[model samples]
Target chain A: MSTGAAEAAWQPSELELSRRSVRRRASTRSVVIALISTVVFAGVIGLALVGSPGWAVVQQTFFNLEIGIESFPAILAGLWVNIQVLVVAAIGVAVFGTLLAVLRSLRGPVFFPLRALATGYTDLFRGMPLLIVLYLVGFGIPVLDIFPRLPAVVWGTIAIILTYSAYVAEVLRAGMEAVHPSQRMAARSLGLTHAQTLRIVVIPQGIRKVVPALMNDFVSMQKDVGLISVLGAVDAVRAAQIEVAQSFNFTPYVVAGLLFVAISWPMIRLTDWASARLAAREQSGGVV
Target chain B: MTVLEVRGVRKRFGDHDVLQGVDLELDAHEVVVLIGASGSGKSTLLRTINLLERVDDGQILLGGDDITDPGVDADRVRARIGVVFQHFNLFPHLRIIDNVTLAARRVHGMPKDTAHARGLELLGSLGLGAKALDYPDRLSGGQQQRVAIVRAIMTDPELLLLDEITSALDPQLIGEVLDLVRQLKSTGSTILMATHEMSFAREVADRVVFMQGGRIVESGPPEQLFDAPVEPATAEFLARVRHH
Candidate 1:
């Protein structure tokens, strides 16, 4: 008990203090060098871009601040549509993707047909380009008159959900497969049914192992939601198209691109931070 | 009464026949220890009995019930048996008490309060009561193995299968885990255990079964099997193991 007080009172030797300062100074020097090099790099790139022969035309078309300011409100209104679609699509992906992953993981011959179907579904969706899927689903479904004519956004949302769940399910399957077989054996030996083992033991560990990967898909999903514009949803991309048609300036498209980047940047940073924490925890080899 | 009857079981993985027409039986309250070299099929036999593995050919009777039939519910059969593994496969996300009591509450439909009480008391008797709230990763290897034992016995299974439980522990930690097994044996739990520790086998087993190359070479009471082996392979194995 007394050792705690003694340990707390202990101090570094002079040599240890010098080593600490040496490490601190080395990091500070690197930071300063990086800042100088980055500024110089940007300056060179800027000068080259400005010195190009068509700079005047490019600026008038793509960097028109007046047009960007004028189109900002409409683009912002359309962004609300993109946000709503992203939220709904994300929930659908989590549920449908997990069900697909569980199906793929089934063990016996009795589940072979289901396993094959789920596998084929993922392969078809993941391999097909998203643009083609959007066009086919967007234009194709209404022709069948599947129900009373619905808004194009509903079809567009369905297309995105179908494609993205393939991706999410694969990531989750990788995570589930990474879980050691012994865990499953232990759960089964304890008399838990296969479904019970998956719910209580396997899937929880699987999801944890792939949190960073899941976050990457989530960030990618935010941008793809804008693809709904192709179906004439008047989402941000569509709103930007209107401004571009009226003024014949490409500035609104650039504005829309920057808006997408603005929303996605925080999630990108979060994914990196999560990846770092996961890596650190995994290196310790004891984290559940 | 015979607690388990494994009749002419066979298992194959790739070209290797892991269990080659093996037969084994354990009577109620009989502590049988299986001694074998690596890949001798002892562990495979235990796994098949628990239905963690499917046998290519055989019938496994647990208390006269034909458990190997395709129509038989494997989960309900497994509920009547307890098993511990070499690596102490405790559920990593759960607390020690949750790991101990999960089967009792989930599989058997024991109420949460009653299961918790039973789990805590068992952990207490095993010197692990204070560590109940901690995760398995937080415990030392010996402590984790003890918790695994508690998890195994929580349901009072008709038979217990221990597959090299002490093989993964440090030398200093092995005694604590073996002591718990000794306690289980004294309490008359019908146990079929596989072990590499020859000395512990001598001390704890009522009967010793020697297996070689996927077949039971010989078996008898511990003294007769260890001291006066009838099979040349059995004596050769004992000599080689003891020489090490």
Candidate 2:
């Protein structure tokens, strides 16, 4: 670290330093301009909002600081339940969807029944609304007295798996089918069997192609985990409901909504970033 | 001796006939270049020869065996032929040397060490030895195509089908791949190639076959065909290609 004088490459030339300084100054100026514009626009909107006639009543009901603070602990605790359900449901959807995709991908007249069944399952579940599935599974399973009366959270997780797996399976199948027939020919020409070709060559490439689409589904799933609160699960939304009832104010609901935005916004941005990166990678191949 | 004979080969995709009763032949150590517009069925003809596309009606004789016969094993027939595609079609995930050796080792049962030795030697000769451990995408487009040529030939198939191998390359990169093909030709590998490069065909090909509407319109020595094309379609195609 002390050998700076010996390190000839460490010094940039005067002209180079001047060029870099101009670029840096331009960047700093743009940052200042952007900050000024954003603050001015936000200030205008804030003044308009506060200047409205209903501000006093609206603020007392929806923006009560005391109620929001009091309900934060319960809402955070309930989010832990959503996280557990999300983890289990994500694994379930991946395993079940892949199996269904494999079943659908089987060739020959002999496996027509399996293909038809897998196709029918994806069509049926993808068509059904997630809320209705939750209601039916949440209510119907308990009525059947299945396995000593499972909790609503368990049933909600199951319902999510049933619905989301259909989406995942379809995405995966599209990926597999989109793998060019030429690639198969290339593999088979090397004397690989149809099954061996799919395993070794086709499936891996297929999964790679649809990774961006798969990440979109993952981001969507994070938002829908909030819906589990409807099935009498003490998840964030339900916890907010209990808090709002006790306080007789809308601030608790606002807290829950903001918490969800905070949790899922970064993932939504991440999916967008990944999609752009994948498109770039496809165009110019390097580390995929 | 005839290495390949295509007799009355016809292939149809839906309502459009891709190959309309075509016949051609190639001898040992000979180079036949197919030149035509994009949809003239030269690529489809190559695919049918390698058994990637089934012929609607025809006979293809590879070394006196009727390969187009329904009972013939397609994979076995394909293994006996080498193909270099326009897009370089290299397996992106595999290292350059692995791509070269995979088919030779898997289908021909060549031992790993033997295949690797040959692979490295061939790559080294082509100026790709230092890149042996890198994946296909890491190399330039021209280099990847050279690697593909290596993959196609390292197995030493009886016949080689090059389907528009340089069409997908950049203008500057095209020469690198063409040079490799020229090198392959000097080594006496029998090749049936499809290309848009008229000059390369004139220089390397024993015969140039011109096609129009899935039919071979004319065929002769490159000098006879390119300089004194008998068919109007052939002359017009040549004029258009030269204008470009």
Candidate 3:
């Protein structure tokens, strides 16, 4: 009798069902809004160019463009200059970055001020836009008579080193910090000097972790060589700019863009592949 | 001869005191186990002996030399006293063989071949020779801790300070590490360990010292401390930890 009475009293509550339905509708509205925005963005881009001369000219110059077999030599020459700039600047940054990182991480008397100075240097360069840094180094420094006889190409190279070293130092610092405090304790307990422990253990692990980041930084520096055009340095971008200036046509700008893409494409793809490989190895138990 | 002495050791962080007026001594070839609650300053004391922690106020002596003296060369003294931490702070970047051989070659000026051979031999004794080329992460917690001990002993320090070396191991694996420590007792090496394994302490330690609130509340032969502790605090601590 009691079970039958309970069954008679049972009824589906409409308020609870209605509240759940309201939440579902609200969530669907948000998703709908998001999708509508994406479509609207595409529509805006499509409409914005329909009557403009920019895209037509871009398409005509880029699609119909072809460098003669003779012009290939000049393109190759520019490519070589880009390679040289990247290699030299990367080497300089490696040596300079390691020295600065070590000094920053050190303790005791001499290192404190050096740490501050290195930190200030990293911050000053990193905070400034790369173009501004290039401009300052390339044109402004010569006015001060420091490295007065140095070529514009040398000044551009210096700008790359200054900007990239700041980034590399932070990468190196993260690697160093990843080493556990207990390892330092164990080293000290073994009666090994601070320098000895750093040289043998901490630095090796740190260098390994920072390798990918360093490579990525190097790639960015390679691309930034494009900015050396402002100094009239004869890199790939400058070569294209000079060619475009003579003809008053925008084809060389597109060609310069293509050159950048050519150089950066392989580097980007290689870093991506390297990162994936590293990630796979890490998942399989490679040390960080 | 007294191998280690700590007098009026007091350590504080901010307004809180971690160790208060602590005094301790370790004789030659003695195996002392320091038992205490977490944060009782037992680990702090051991670290201070290695100069890994600078004591706020105290004097520490090793083999009649004042290690706490401002003029003393801490690195030289540390070379004579090896310490193994709870976490086997092995250099993860280096192979197990390199981790063990590095200090021997760098600090003691041992040739690479000699250091490599000794490292292999030590690994063999620990039953870890197969993993000598592997990184620290590849080894189990117990295996890594054992490797840490070998790395420390490769330096051949006169005294070894083991700070809760087996505390991090799984219960089943704790036995193997403690067994290695028990076997080490027979090697005539002076050892001071901060351990949670009560039965292991009774088995291996020549003397058992119970500490609470950063002071040695009671200490005696392992039999007496384990069987009928004189202090209530010691008895209470043993009762709490004996179940584990």
Each prediction's total of clashing residue pairs, residues at least 3 apart in sequence or on different chains, is 0, 0, 0
- Candidate 2 per-residue lDDT, tens place, B1-244, comes to 9999999999999999999999999999999999999999999999999988899998999999999999998888888899988887887767899889988888788999999999999999999999999998899989998998999898888899999988888999999999999998999999999999999999999999999899999999999999999999999999999999
Full-model lDDT, candidate 2: 0.91
lDDT minimum window of 10 residues, candidate 1 chain B: B18-27
Q: Per-residue lDDT for B1-244 in model 3, tens only?
A: 8898989988888998888888889998899999989988889888888888788998999998988899999999998988888888988888999989878988889999999999999899878999999998899999999998998889778899999998888998898888888777888889999998887888898899888887889999999999999988888888888766
**What's the lDDT for all of these models?**
0.95, 0.91, 0.84
The TM-scores, one per candidate, come to: 0.93, 0.76, 0.85
Could you report the DockQ of all the candidates, in the order they appear?
A: 0.81, 0.37, 0.68
Distance (Å) between predicted and true CA of A185, model 1?
A: 1.4
lDDT of 1 by residue, B40-157 (tens): 9999999999998899998899999999999999999999999999999999988999999999999999999999999999999988999999999999999999999999999999
The 10-residue segment with the lowest total lDDT in model 3 chain B: B235-244
TM-score of 1: 0.93
Residue lDDT tens for model 2, A139-169: 8888886568778999999999999999999
